[model samples]
Target: MLQLPHQSLQVAAVPAQRTAAREDQDGPWHTEAVCRRDEAGLFFAPSKEPTAARLSREDAAKRVCARCPVMVECREHALLQPEPYGVWGGLTAAERRVVLARRRRREMELKKSASAA
Candidate 1:
């Protein structure tokens, strides 16, 4: 895991689209901040494939998420956008579904409590 510098929590502002000089896909902003990488024999490299499958990619993401600083924000974005592909917020699609279910459950519980009170 990369030890981020000690600075205030600043949300990374990813441009909706990349600049002409730098294509959206060919920049640190796309991969470094948004994707997980694995530490190989002696180097850290991004995952070869961006798509997620059953276990391999999930395992890789779990390791990267163990140290990601903006995991919360990432997950929130993924949930809100209903991203159909790739790993986001350190969670796979199925995991995000579980999270959404839990969140909805909690919201219902809160509403019930408020009504009873």
Candidate 2:
């Protein structure tokens, strides 16, 4: 079985202390993540994983994300970090890429409109 770091595993178990620390370091939103209660393997793929298995695992992780209260924050973090692996905020790596592309395009369009005006 894959084991997460001790700190990651303890997030939900020690909410008050962890939330305060995480808020100081990363942000308060992470303290409310539902994924903290699940196994890390559910969100990240194992090395050399098969496509079907990876899809199934990602789907399961997304289901957990779907109900999360901090999903938007998590997704924004992933997009800003351009997270290269795993499923974050109900989206796989490929999905994040598409979103980034769209964001870039929109920004470019906005810039063009501003310059034209």
Candidate 3:
């Protein structure tokens, strides 16, 4: 029932239903994603999109993600799958890479401490 900026109510409803059906078959978390009812373009950049436009679009997409019930699940999925594009779980692809790197560093530190102990 939530309508996104520049998106019609009718447009929002269709994807919501599709996401619901997908959830029935795929899983429940996806059905609850706020992005499911929104346009994919809001989250993804087109080829050669302007820098300002891409940043604006990504910020809007992150706003939707901010309210998602399944945000943690979605973020974890993105992290694990290493999705190569778009804004996932409130993070840009670059942001996800940073997170992954930090995690790897922390893990290595822990391993080193364990081995030393």
State how far residue 26 of model 1 sits from its true place (Å).
21
Candidate 1 achieves a global lDDT of: 0.51
Indicate the worst ten consecutive residues by lDDT in candidate 2: 8-17
Better of 1 and 3 by TM-score: 3
Whole-model lDDT for model 3 versus the true structure? 0.70
Candidate 1 steric clashes: 0
The Cα local distance difference test for each model comes to: 0.51, 0.71, 0.70
My TM-score estimates for the predictions, one after another, are 0.53, 0.77, 0.77
Write candidate 1's Cα lDDT for 44-107 as tens digits: 2234433332255356556666566655656666787666444566776777888888999999
The residue-by-residue lDDT of candidate 3 on 13-81, one tens digit each, is: 111122222244456777678876745557666667667666777888898889888888778777887
Please list the residue runs of candidate 2 whose C-alpha ends up more than 4 Å from where it truly belongs after superposition.
1-27
Candidate 1 C-alpha RMSD relative to the actual structure: 12.3
Residue pairs with colliding backbones in model 2 are none
Prediction 1 TM-score vs. true: 0.53
Q: Which stretches in model 3 have alpha-carbon errors above 4 Å?
A: 1-26
lDDT measured at residue 23 in model 1 versus the true structure, 0 to 100: 27
Clashing pairs in 3: none
